[model samples]
Target chain A: MIRLNRLCAGYFGKTVIQEVTMEFLPGKVTVLLGPNGSGKSTLLKASLGLLPLTGGEVLYDDVDIRRLKRRQIAQKAAFLTQSRNTPSIQALRMVLHGRFPYLTYPRHYGGQDYAIARGAMDATGSRQHENTNVSLLSGGQRQGVYLAMALAQDTRTLFMDEPTTYLDIGRQFHMMRTARSLAREGKAVVLVLHDICLALREADRVAVLQEGRLLCLGEPDAIYQSGALEQVFGVGVHRVDTPHGMQYYCVPQQVPGRIAEECQNT
Target chain B: MSSLRIFSTRRSDIIFWAGLCALTLGAAALGLWTGSVKLEPAQVLDALTGRDGTSAAARIVLYSRLPRTCAAMLAGAALAVSGAVIQTVLDNPLASPSVIGVNSGAGFAVALVCAAAPLAQRYTPLVAFGGALAGVLLVAGLSQRTGASRMTVILAGVAISAMFSAGIDTAVTLVPDAISGVTDFRIGGFTGVTMAQLAPAAGLIFVSLGIVFSLSQQMDILALGSDTAQSLGLSVGPVRITLLVLAAALAGAAVSFCGLMGFVGLIVPHTMRRLLGKGSLSLMVSSALGGAFFVTMCDLAARVLFSPFELPVGIILAFAGAPFFLWLLFKQRGGRT
Candidate 1:
């Protein structure tokens, strides 16, 4: 539903993401993979109209997004930014803000809105904590609340920036599973993750960025085989076959070329 | 399950509003009745009802008790609400109108007005509002340009406040004889506030209060941080500026009439946030009620605590507020409030 054409975006007259092109289709978990300062967040913000575009335009369907107001863009995309403040408010209230894009001036919410928010909480398995103060929640529980908020937004596209950061291993599995299920439900799921193996294993399509440039975009397996992870992140990846299916694991390689081949052979 | 939670929360909100109303009424009545004249509650009521028309009791009630009480309550609510909004906008608990130089900005402007046109008492609030808005905009603009952290905003505000204080001093020294009422402007009291002086400031306070209430939900979203608020489709820049402008207006109007009553904004809203939550609507409402009661009681105490020798209301507020500020600093060591 969204397309980026030669997009160049940055802050304060300095371009960090330059000449990038990609498409986010329905029923796909498109994970953006990159090292530090690779413009992953900037590219995401530019796509969501959160940053000023210096060059090419972003299109929502066929129309340029500049024609849209923040509210209008919000109707099409529910964006979860990287950093969030912990205000001492109810978790349910946090989720209810997902209905904000649908609200008009005076921004009133009603029974239906509350019902929808509750339903979202249920979907994210966070209903139990609805009455709890969000600030007091554990890191994993807080991420769950934020995920519930995105679910409550009820948009066709959801963008999560580093959703897995503070999650423990078990919670990471749960988050990845949720993202996969969300894509299966035909929503465009675009996320940025630092974990190479997690991104490669879970993503339907992987987009690797290097120094603000798109290195590769294809099926996860193809991108992995292209050595883009090693090239961009200096990481060694090896594929292993298990009872269920093929899985990939990556480890940082101080000396790039031989370590990956060694990992594959072993 | 969520509905049950909602119901309980709503009930609590109702309880809070009702309880605050009772307390505010009691405080206001005491303010009206307890004075140097030693009038009874019956005499106060009779004066209020106009049954003692033009009598000594009636004149005291009409001229002294009524204006001062209204001034004290309105000033409290305005300053408290302003501080709350400022704190939210800057995303710093320590950011208040008084702390962030909003009052000092108004004080500086009032001093300039006194120096330039001592006959411009009618325009003091307006002048103060302009000064306050300019000061807040400068501070906010600086913070934004520098990409400030929460603590940085408060620091910037303190620096700006200090600069304004210097300007105020210079203004006072430039024509010390012209602005003889500088202490009255600085100390802030309701004692001689004619209804004429209170009316304009009251109008500005009410209008500003209305706007803040209407935008409470938006303000809550704003407290969520700039990126999240913008992602949620809030016009963060405009909404933040609007909130800051209103905060300045509220503080400016109050300071124009009552002098810089420090920490009413900081103390009342911070306390209300603890009693309630950070829900902007409830926090603002509770702050208003709590502030009205707090300032009224302080005013009453200033007049009666050492009867026959009234102290300026600001003195009492400073005594209470400065320690509360220190306590907040102590509590915030863990970096969450």
Candidate 2:
């Protein structure tokens, strides 16, 4: 479990995320929701100590994150940044770097390391590109490869910012399903996504932020019923029943005196 | 903390290494034999093993040609390895010791030493190393303070290089009398080199090489952008600084006695990268072997081209390097670093 206590952080001390407190519980998929510059990414980086905290501290299972070395923090959690370099290296080599925290000095990866890296590549469906150069990979393939690296990290917690950015619609759903499965396996999975409908359908807990403050934080259903999404995003939220299961929809509100008409149940 | 291999050794890579090793040995042998007073391979071996007692040719080989060849080989290896590390870390092909002003930093220090002490020549290598380290750290610090993007680092390095060149000009102008061999030093050569001068530079280069080679995996990790490297538990800032320090030591030691020789650092590494891809281990190994071969051949050409007049090695490097670099730039179409 990771707790951000009254976290106040920003670039150059502008305080993008002001006094934000939150807990990411294990065995749950937590999604951070907000408009552009609402500080979703800032909050994540601050929590990891990648940026300096202005007011509060992050605690990992009651231990202050500041007290731990970077290697220790890495063992506790894996982070996938939205913006990353496409180095001219083999895909398998990139995945192997996930085992870096575990590597001792002189840092040679042994036979077991290769096995786990191959397993990660298999899990992410990047096995075909294992020996290929990452620079030559397509956008979607690159996303999959990066995801494989995070999976190879084998931490108890995963934090991915825009993991589906370059992914196709099918791959996006596949990634969300993978996150849900990881949560089912008793690991914490946190994501920041703009697709409200997909997030509502998948996340166990939703944290909605408006203007750098938490608009609401709770189970997805509770957050939806509280109207926080409508309040912040000015949308009409609807719940529909399908043959498969219950589905959620978001439609823009009409002009004054007009009832919301686009949202309909299946 | 489970381990994982970053790069795998393949059969082609073995062939590449073996070929480069053979070429380097052949170049070294050619360098040792074909100087002003030529000696046969057997004669050279006899001299090396102290079989020719009190012969002038043995004296010449031992005292003169041997030191010069060793100097060229060491300089080649140091600058080439240094450049490869810098290119990978900075994520730019053009960010080598000479291009980024690290060599100029060392040249500036040597110039100042020559002007200020004149007779305290033995301390120049150590002073030059200090200057080079300071130069790289200053540029890196400036870029880091502003945001450490690849472009920022390159531009900062260019600015620092210009500033150091100005410093070198001032030092040379103020104490002209003290630096009698300033021109020769400006254009690098191994003529009149001695065992005493080559000893310290060789030792420094060797130590720096050992340390950098040991950290091949770390270098590759750093080559992965900062965020990825940091999250992977690499102490990004410290590790980056340490690599740069080693690179500076290399550039400094090479320039300590050889002046600001370019191209070996800039060109040899680029050539190796083209042949061997970007794995640090392969890039570094090829750079060592390839750099030695390139410099040894260039020194041989410089010695024999104009015969007794003896062209400085830097001129031959520039004459060859400029066109090769232009072709490389064209091939990459804006430097695909």
Candidate 3:
């Protein structure tokens, strides 16, 4: 389990995330839900040591994450950063980089590393574009390649920031399913997502943040019962039960009233 | 249970390497056979075997053509590999040794060494290596201080290059006599290099190439961006600095031998990426070979094109490289938005 204790982090001196505490357990999916600029990405980055800790420490099973060597931490935790640049590299080669923690200097990737990478590619259904340059891949294919890279890391803990952004609904479902499988395989999967229905349907637990503060953290149903998502996102939350599972739908709150007020003022 | 398959390369990779090898050999042969005295294949063979005595043809072949050809090949490979490393590390296609002021830094150091002590000229390669590191460090340090964004780094590099070029101008004005022997060097040509002089630069290039190859995987990971690379266990800052140092060493060693040759680094690596794809290892190897072929071919052209008049190889490269670089900049901008 990875735990954040009073974590404070940001760029330069301005703290984007402050005094936040959270715990991620193995064999479950913990989804971080927040509106824009709500410090979800910052909190995740701080926990992984990608951002400097201004106050508290991230403890991995009672040991400070910062105290451990990078490779040691990497051996346990893998991260999939927000989709950004797709390097002009072959997809399989990009996946193989996840084996870096296990690789020692002077020994390049061996057959075992290849096996792991290929397994990851197979798991993510990215084997079709294994030899293709990632830059040429479609949005869905590109996300799959990056997820395959994180999967190839083969860590006990995985963190993904906005993995489904820019992806089609089909790809988003595919990604969430893959994340579910990783959790099922006994990995701690933490993700930041904006789609509340996907979060409600897929997340074992959900943490909501608003203006750099944790509004609530609990099981998805409990958070839904608490009616916190409506307050955090300024939207009305409606829940329904489908044959598959619970489903959530949201609509912007008081839109007609706000427009009427603006018209009166003008 | 099913079989496990890991990393695999397409058949094109095999064909690419083979083609590059054959092309290099052909270029090398043509390099050897097409000098002023224009030796026949038999004469070239006899010269290689030391069957001929110290005839004028043998002297030209053994002393002049041999070292110049080797220098061109080595310089080309060094610059191209340096460019490839810089492009990957910076994650910007526009970044090259010359664009980032590495060449200007080495050139400034060479100028200073020459002006400081004419007899100490043999240490120019070492001093130039130090200078290249300092120059790149200056740019990197400044960019890091300002923000370390790709745009900031590129702007810092341009500023640093302008500053170093000014320094070079000052050094030349201060010591006119010091530049007499470096005239061909300043123009970036392999005119009068001897075997002994070419040896040290060759040593640096070969060793630095080894280091670059060993670190190629890390560099590939780095191209994924700093956050992802660091999260993957790479100490991004140190690995980046080390790679930059190695790149500086490469650009410096090349600049020490052949003055501030541009476009070989920019053009060769970019070409290799298009032809061989973006595997750093393949790009490194193929870029080195492609660069060697490119510069050697350019040198051959410079020698033969205007014949006795002879043009500097840099002139040939600039004509080819500048337009492509501009096109790349536009293409990158188009891709982004």
Candidate 4:
């Protein structure tokens, strides 16, 4: 489990994420949803110790994460940003690098490392393209390769920032399904998702943030009922029941004066 | 099953070793045969084994050709490996010792040593090494503060290079008579190399090569983006700094000996990347051998083409390497984002 206690962080001198307390439970997928520039990425970075915490502390299994070495932190959690590009030929060897922390100086990967990397490739369904250059792969294939690299780390926690962005509809759903399955395998998977519907469908729990503050954190049912996302997004939302599950959709509730002004301008 | 696979993979690596040996032997032969007072293959071999031969050919082989050959091989390997390391560390194909100003820094130091300290005039390599280190430190400090952006680092290197060249100009203007042989050194040659110069430089180059070879895997990891490297449990910052220092040291030692032989570092690694796949281990070894061959050939051309009036090897390399560099730049430009 990863816990954040009154954490604050920023770049240079400006603070992007305020004091925020949260916990990520294992065997669960926690989706963080927020509007643009709402500090969602910052919070994730702070949790991973990528950015310095200005006010509070983050703990992994009750141990202060900031005090741990970077390699140790890497062994505990794997972080994947939206897009990562590397040399085309170095792609597979790059994935094998996930075994670095376990090796000593003059490090060389042994059989166990290759086994883990191959296992990760198989798990992510990237085995066919193991020898392919990453740059030559399509967006979805590259995303899978990156996911395989993260999985190769064998960490308990996985942090992804919009892993499905820039992908087609099919790829988006495929990636979300992969994340859900990974969470089911007992890893704590945290994701920052822009697509609210996708988050509502895949997330075991949802956290809503606005203006660097956590407005709501609960299961989908409770968060949907709270009207927190509606207020945060400044729109009207309807929670409807489908045969499969609960679905939430947003609608624009017209304000008389603003609507008239926008119409006149158009 | 995996062990068998790895063993087979190891077996194929023999091809790379064989190729390197072939190139090394060819370059050594060329270096021996293409000097003034050239000896036949048998006489060169006889001289090499310290067997009886024509005294003039033996003396030429021992005193002149051998040291030049060793110097060329050592400098070429050092520069090539250093370039590869820098390119990987900076994640820029253009990040060569010459392009990024390490050689210019060493050159300026030699120029200054030639002008100021009489003792430094005799021990020019030490001064050049010191200057190279200082130059690397300056670039590192500037780039670190600015977040080491690709354009920023390159621009900073160019700016520092210009400043150092200006310093060289000033020193030359002040003490013209002090550096009567400065022109030939600046152009770079292997005509007058002695064994004494080759010995210490060879030792330093090997040490640097050993350090880089040991860290080859980590370097391969680092060639990925910084975030990926960090995620993979490699300490990106320290690893980059360490590799940069190692690259500077190797480049420095090479410049101290060869007077800024350009293009070997920039060209060799890229050629290896194209020929062999980008496995760091194979690329590193291939680059070392390729560099040695290229420099030896260039030096040989310099010796034979002009015959009695020897042209500096640097001129030949610049003439050849500059056009290739321009072609690469245009290709990269056409493919730009």
Best model per TM-score: 1
lDDT of 4 by residue, A142-211 (tens): 7777888899889999999999888899888888888889988999999999987778778999999998
- Candidate achieving the largest lDDT: 1
Candidate 4 residue-wise lDDT, B220-278, digit = tens: 77766777777677777888888888888788788877886778889989888866665
**Whole-model lDDT values for every prediction:** 0.88, 0.84, 0.87, 0.81
Give candidate 4's total backbone clashes: 0
* A27-145 per-residue lDDT for model 2 (tens digits): 99999999889999988887777888888889988899889899988888888889877666778888998899999866788898899999988888898888777878987888778
RMSD to the true structure for each prediction, in A, is: 3.2, 4.8, 2.7, 2.9
List, residue by residue over A1-266, the lDDT tens digit for candidate 1. Answer: 99999999999999999899999989999999999999999999999998999999899987899999888888888887787788877888888998998997667888899999999999889989988888789877887888888788888899999988877898888888999999999999999999888887889999999989999999988997798888787768988998867888877677756879889999
The per-model DockQ list reads 0.66, 0.48, 0.61, 0.56
Candidate 1 segments whose C-alpha is farther than 4 A from its true place: A256-266, B1-10, B177-181
Q: For residues B54-101, could you state the per-residue lDDT of candidate 1 as single tens digits?
A: 789888888999999999999999999999999899888888988888
Off by over 4 Å in 4: A88-91, A234-266, B1-17, B52-54, B121-123, B177-180
Pairs of residues clashing in candidate 3: A114-B6, A114-B7, A115-B6
Tens digit of lDDT per residue, candidate 3, span B17-93?
88899999889999989965667888877887899858877778889888988999999999999999988877777
Which lDDT value does model 2 have at B297?
Answer: 90
DockQ for model 3?
Answer: 0.61
Better of 3 and 4 by lDDT: 3
- Each candidate structure's TM-score, on Cα atoms with residue i matched to residue i, is 0.95, 0.91, 0.94, 0.92
